[model samples]
Target: MDKSDITLERLRSFVRVAERGSLSAVARELGVGQSTITRHLRELETALGVPLLNRTTRRVSMTDEGARYYANCLQILRLVEQAGDEARATRGAPAGTIRISCTAAIGVLHVTRLIFAFQDRHPDIGIDLSLTDERVDLVREGVDVALRLGPLTDSSMKLRNLGHSRRLLVAAPDYLAAHGRPAAPQDLSGHEGIRMTNVAGSDTLVLQGPDGARHTVPFGGRFRVDHGLAAREALAAGRGIGSAHRWLVDDLLSAGRLEVILPDYVPLSVPLNMLIVPQRTGIARVRLLVDFLAERIRAIPGIEQTR
Candidate 1:
């Protein structure tokens, strides 16, 4: 086997193809032609003296040897990338792409603007932002950091607690005028309830009173949504009353499009956290973005810092 013939390019192509299970898909992802991907695989296999992939017309599967090699390659590539990151970090100007993951609603409503500002400060740095509500594996996805809402499940990734995201029950002024404003927690069930389909027990509204009381009220309505932005829109349209993160509807509230109902009561706050891949903690660009985001996110309208 010719070890010298095995290059980073070949390893990267092999890794992408193995993960995607489609040579053509990997080709498009890498912005290269299928022929080039095929050649990379061929050369890699020749250099290793092993058949790496079992390719048929429909799909590609990794050989046992390929699977083992793929795992090792992931570590090797990560180390190489880490070395590059550290080297760049030591220079005068930090430069490299930072991959970030965030929930779609916050990404669109707030985080994107912060990212734009971050770019303004560091022109050489590039950002690859993935907007999704699903929890993604940062290492598997090659993400540098992720801004996550609610409680987290994974213990492997490093954590930075941003704070609890404060929430409130709100309705449009037009809706209030048509349906009558809810005077208290009991009055909420009589009015339409715009609940989240994604959240567990969203049909039940839990509010903490200013007097240190917890109110559990049955909540339901004609409109149920999974996305935060959708919930904000529904509230603005006066479809129903629902809980919204303060950051999600601050503008509408300020504009009088949406009004807070039951001012004495507040919905349960969700935890907002930043998760970083263990290997990326020391990278300068990652650290810069992480610190920048933490500071900016805390300064947001309804983000309450935790002790």
Candidate 2:
């Protein structure tokens, strides 16, 4: 085997292709031509004198040997990155790109502002923020950290509980004028409820009463949306009363565009968590940003620390 033919770039290309299962996707991610990715794969395979990836027209699958090699390559790349991080940390301010993933609405409303402030404070550190509602695999996607809402199913990653996202029942003034306001939990049954199609129990609303009792009521509407922004827009447009994260409609509430419906009754709060890849947690930039976010996120208007 020609050991010299195996390079870091080739290993990275191979790993990305293996994880993403698309040569073209890897090329786009790395900002290189597809031919470059193909050549790197070819050279790496030639050096090892074995076929690592089985390339079909539709998809790329790794051979048994390729899977093992991919694991090793990931470790090698992480070690290399950590070494660079340590070297840079010792010299001065933490300087490196930290990739972060967050839910779409939170990203747009609060996290983006926090990130901007963070960057201003530490100009040397670079941040890459990806906003998506879908839960992505951090290790596979090369994401350093992720901010997630609701309970996390995966326990393998390092976790920090920022707090719970406070939710409120809200409606526009005109909506209340037309449908009449709900005075209590049961009053909701007679009203049209704007629902989220993506949430698990969109048809049912679980609210915690002021006296600490739980109330489960049927929630349905003619209009259903999958995105928080869309739901906020629907509420603002006087579509119907709906549950919203306090941060999502805080501006509207302050501006009197939306009013709290049955202020004493509240929807069940969802957990807000920060998840970090085990290997990336110790990197200087990653650690710094995590700390920064943890502190800042707690201060958001609608975020409250769990007891």
Each candidate structure's TM-score, on Cα atoms with residue i matched to residue i, is 0.90, 0.95
Candidate 1 C-alpha error for residue 192, in Å: 1.1
Per-residue lDDT tens digits for candidate 2, residues 157-200, read 99999999999999999999998988789889888889988899
Residue pairs with backbone atoms closer than 3 Å in model 1 (clashes):
none
Model 2 CA deviation exceeding 4 Å by range: none
The RMSD of every model to the true structure, in order and in angstroms, is 2.3, 1.5
Model 2 has an lDDT value of 0.91
What's model 1's overall lDDT? Answer: 0.90
- Candidate 1 lDDT by residue in tens digits, 7-48: 999999998888778898778877899999999999999988
CA lDDT of every candidate: 0.90, 0.91
